[model samples]
Target: MKPKELTRAIVQAFIIIVLLIGLYQVVLSIQSVLSYILIAAVVSLVGRPIAQLLKRIKFGNTLSSVTTIAILMTTFFGIVSLLLPVIFEQAKNLSLLNVNAFEATATKLMNELSIYLLDYGVDLQSWVDRSLAEVDYSFLPDTINTVLNGLSGFTIGVFSVIFISFFFLRDSGLLERMVMVFVADKNIKRVEKSIFSIKNLLSRYFIGLLVQITVLFIVYTLVLLIFGIPNAVTIALVCALLNIIPFLGPIIGTVLIVFLTMTSNLDASFASVTLPKTIYVLIGFTIGQLIDNFLTQPYVFSTSVKSHPLEIFIIILVGGLLFGPLGMIIAVPLYTALKVIFKEFYAHNKIVKALTKNI
Candidate 1:
């Protein structure tokens, strides 16, 4: 190529690269805004059915949207209010905790475990000592401070999400219109169909998740109460919330419940009271999980989302690998959306056709 032509091409490429880099930096700077938008979109999708129901009863568009938002806010704050007192009480208990007593209790338990495991040649004491030596408690104060500092941002984000969700609910097609701006005229209709399908499927999927959490919460609370665990309701809520993360969530929730249960009555005799109670609580948790796996999950995954169980498992694993817990939480909905889009644009592809057949 001529020198001048080569020079011009290099300049053009440099400008394009510079523009892309600037866009990336801008996106990074505005990431919080993007998060608010994504969250608001989910909120709107979840509330869409309520808004539609209100509209069917002759409510004005604005009135339906306002009422839906009010209902959602009330429910959210109601749960928060119920949880806050328990949380504060727990925090106060932590602040006033007798560290030496806790340590002694832990040591006693470890000793008993070591005695039981001695026959198997497992030296838990040495392992525990090494683990304790490596532990870092210095992050506690900094973590607390960070949480306190982030409160203001969290408040702003909540308000922003509510504001955006109201508009989204009031104008059901607003997101579609925004998306249409970037689509070619020829593809606009296909994109519209895809959006509509995604909205419906995702709305049901999210609602199904809410139902699943509610069921699990009820079961967990009953079990905890039956076992007379301290802060049973709060602990149950936390565990139930964790179940939103698919396969890994239940295991984490079980471990958390067991830990909390054991710690709650540390003064009691381990062999007689603590161990038996922990075992009972663990059994209850297993029952709750059985109900969830056999009943709640099938309806949610097969009926609401219309995805195969194996497909979901693989996607969630991949998502967890790529982006951790948040990815697992969102993987199904994102996958559902992509499948819809692909089916619209690539109906002839065998894999796309197979994946999207249920939709």
Candidate 2:
């Protein structure tokens, strides 16, 4: 290739890379605003049907939205009020446990394991020592405190979401008309179809989530109570809420539940040691999650959004890397929107149609 052509191509690639990096930085900077928009979308999708139901019951659209918001607000506050004290107490005890005993035990175990591995010629001691040297053991307390401080902000966001959802629920007609006018003017059928697909996907996903959350809450409460765990009700409620986040949710929930159960009984505090307790927790979570993945979401959201597990995982990882926990939460819905748009493009593309015919 000519030097001028090659130089032009090189400059183009450089410009693209710089632009992408700048775009990513901007995304991260405005992530909190993006998070609120995502939360509002999900809430609006979930509450739309209820608002319609209220309208059918003779309420005006504004009144219906108000009623729906009121129900959600009441339910949320009621659950929070009941569970707050127990959760706070458990969190305090868990923190104290970490400082007083757990950290020492963990350090001792690591040292013993390192020694054992060195005897076996594994050379694991150096790795362990390096890792320990780099870690800030004191960071846990600060992390927990930071998360606790953020709860008030989270609550305020919840209110913001509800307020935004009200506009969506009450003024949906105007919004639809505006969208239709814009799309019709541009003659963009694909965009229209993609939007509808995303709306349906989000609506179905939220409904499935509600059903799964309710079932899991019941199951968790019963199982924990049967296992003689203290504060089972509060723990179960917390677990249900946490489980809304997908994969990592269960790990955090399990750790918190197990820690609470351990402290609830000095005798059965053999949580980390007892085979029965560990197995029970594993088996219960496995069954519950299996039911949710296989039955609930599939049946409810089958027509809405369909993507492979690997794709979903990638989206989640990217989202979290860009936006943290909130990104992880909205990854599925965003992916669903992408999937719908791509599918429509595939369906209409002449090349794709020819390839399908050949296959």
Candidate 3:
């Protein structure tokens, strides 16, 4: 083949490969719509035992699941409502963060530094005022509107989740029975083991994540409150909830809290006031993470999932990239299912060993 022709062929192959990968990703995104239902089913299975226990005590599964969901909805919506007032107050206060306040704080800081240090000729106040004035605040409203719309859409999904969860809770036994029907009697043991593995692993992962978030929430809340931070509860709750997403969440939370503290305490200036806020965030996250990795996760998840740290990290990254935050949350459970499937498949194949060597 001519060099140009060969190069053209190679380029065509690369483009085809890229297009195939992109198509696969699009399919995965479409699949995520049903993945949400799958997650609700998993959650229902996990909580079905509790529902059944409640049933034995005279509560119907529908009533028990409704009660559980109601409590969950109330807690989540209550927190959101409580925090929104404070957040809106802070957001509206944004309009009040005029150039005058910026200049005043900058002037105060420069004056303080000038008294002790060599003369710094920089006009910090002018610089700050000019920067604040030039800031494009036009997009802020649109950004907030987009976020509100997304949240409204999420509420619609929550209704579907609750609807699906009700049936799974009420007829959870049917789930296993249905699966069993597809398996021959001889394969029943293997299928049962795989199912149990999924249940145990998913339950442990969810419970572990919940415990970690709760611990972090308490730690951050106490630290923020001790430092006299306004809206401490809201900030801490947000930070801790973010911790559920592993590495990326705490970083976003820290930036948010720091900006909030800086804005709320301009009189104190950033340097002097920022220390407590930064320190509290660092300490709370560090301690909470230590407890999760060393004490909680080992007790709850390590044995059940039996996944390596690197594997978990990769799975989380893939999940996040493929399906956004929801994917990240479900990554571990899905990985656990895959792990069980691989183990079962290998065991099944071993039973059908070749009668002769490859020759």
Arrange candidates by lDDT, descending: 1, 3, 2
Which residue segments of model 2 deviate by more than 4 Å?
1-19, 88-145, 173-184, 231-233, 267-279, 290-304, 345-359
Q: What's the TM-score of every candidate structure?
A: 0.81, 0.73, 0.72
Best candidate, lDDT: 1
List candidate 1 segments past 4 Å from native.
1-31, 56-59, 88-106, 136-153, 230-234, 263-267
Which of the two candidates, 1 or 3, achieves a greater lDDT against the reference?
1
Candidate 1 clashing pairs, residues 3+ apart or interchain: none
lDDT of 3 by residue, 122-230 (tens): 6655676799999999999999999999898787778877777777776776667878998899989888888887887777677767777788788878877877778
Candidate 2 per-residue C-alpha lDDT over 39-139 given as tens digits, one digit per residue, 9 for 90 to 100: 77676676778888999989997899999888877887898797777768766766555453655665676777788888888877687678989997888
Tens-digit lDDT string for candidate 1 (1-359): 99999999999999999999998788667867876777889999889889999999999999999999999999888867776766575566567767787778768877888999988999888888899999899999999999987898889999999999999999988988898999999998899889889988988898899899999999999999999998888888889988998778898998888777776766676668988999999999999999998899888989888998889889999878855675687789889999999999999999998998988
TM-score of 3: 0.72
- lDDT for predicted candidate 1 compared with the true structure: 0.87
Ten-residue stretch with the least lDDT total in model 3: 350-359
